[model samples]
Target: MGFDWSAAAGTLEVVPALERLELLAEPVASAILQLDDERIGVAEIDPELADTAAFCEQYGSPLELSANCVVVAGKRAGEVRYAACLVLATIRADVNGVVKRQLDVRKASFASMDDAVERTGMAYGGITPFGLPGDWPILVDAEVAAARAVVVGSGLRRGKLIVPGEVLAELANAEVIEGLGR
Candidate 1:
């Protein structure tokens, strides 16, 4: 049978994200207000289950519909570059290859947890592209951008956002790239 979000989400209630800004981190809430996408929704969750695998398992959500946003930092010519890569949970972001090249840095790696949280104003395990700095690039994996709907962090461990993939692809700084996730 096809996935049932209501059943999968268990006892957690999914509601219009804008209606529950209190459940989202400040930055995420602000971003959602700007997005004005009615398709976006939010659900309360256990902060302890913020990680993709754990969240999916605990909520009975399909892993394929989970989107992960990772923060990457690269240094080139004494300048540091940061970007957010959004990919499906079933695969990994090609950080060393695609991300390194995209950032035009000699090396690319996951940003330190402290750095990521500080820069994005989001919890370490709950960073999402929606509230990232305006200057930061948001790399959207082809597969993730093609999904009908996906679950992603709400910029805090206490909640998650459900958004249509096309909405992510259309974000102001989003760049849909092939082979971003592999």
Candidate 2:
């Protein structure tokens, strides 16, 4: 069957695995649903596509057609820690340079998969900026945000959320940035 937001809403059930893991974020889900451009579709897929290339190929969608939101852990000189960063599937965030500079941290690294899962309330490979902590620094690729619509993580490894790109930025309170290299 084709995706229907209303029907999906009526069901309104978090995937069993996500629920059991306690990884679903209600605020993120609700924020995504509240957008005015709410025509986005959500669907689950095979686990193999958790990586960008496989996901694009399997779905017949371009890597440029999707946005990747990542959570990076930064430790500042003063001992403060934070998660940040977002990019399109076609590009990778400059973790050691730009991201570190932005966060004013000497070191920045991708959050460990377990740490990402535990703190973000999202499964590994399914973390999106949608329901992330409001204080986190969210960066977005200009091109991805310019798309009419783009697919993003759905808080579960096996599912994705398709929505207007601009709306996704709004939901994440993200700032558009440049120089995300492929």
Candidate 3:
């Protein structure tokens, strides 16, 4: 909480997340608050820089401290299932290897942008692990949950949320796994 934004490696300008990210979906905001609102911060950014690579490069967020929340959809016995996967920016989610087996589905793939955005009530490229459907599992890479802090979307392209990896580990139904990211 003593971060000197002015001296931040990337010139990060942090504000209390609850104040600047009012547009966050109900669930997303609640998740951050559940972690002790004061522990998280918000940084405004060009909507175009919301993606991990651009945001990290522009905001000075390190790839190792940035995480992506991806949605995977699959079917087993004509029953559809979806899960949210959290992986560090430095690696990709091992969808075919781990995700399929985890979901107990024969196949799995990234959900289409249209469906993900519509169902999550969050904009494309700004989906976070917060507020996901209750039945869906949130699979987090072990390394991601152990990070000091990580940057993730704020449910909108206009900003990002800074939270400690421990906050992620506490997420409802979060399953931390080894080799989840590769």
Q: Which candidate achieves the best lDDT against the true structure?
A: 1
Model 2 segments more than 4 A misplaced: 1-27, 34-37
User: Residue-wise lDDT of candidate 3 within 1-182, one digit each (tens)?
Assistant: 45333322265777777676574666777766766556567787899888888888887778888889999999999999999999999999999989999999999999999999887888889899877887889999999888777887888888787777777777888999899999
Off by over 4 Å in 1: 1-12
The candidate 3 region of ten consecutive residues with least summed lDDT is 1-10
**What does candidate 2 score on TM?**
0.77
Model 3: how far is 4 from its true place, Å? 7.8
CA shift of 15, model 3, Å: 2.3
What number of backbone clashes does candidate 3 have, counting pairs of residues 3 or more apart or in separate chains? 0
RMSD of 1: 2.9
If the candidates were sorted by their TM-score against the true structure, best first, what order would they fall in? 1, 3, 2
Per residue, candidate 2 scores C-alpha lDDT tens digits across 14-39 of 23222222233464565554553335
**TM-score to native of every candidate shown:** 0.94, 0.77, 0.91
lDDT per model, in order? 0.88, 0.65, 0.82
Error of 3 at 99 (Å): 0.9
lDDT of 1 by residue, 26-53 (tens): 8899999998767788899989999999
Pick out the ten consecutive residues of candidate 1 with the lowest summed lDDT: 1-10
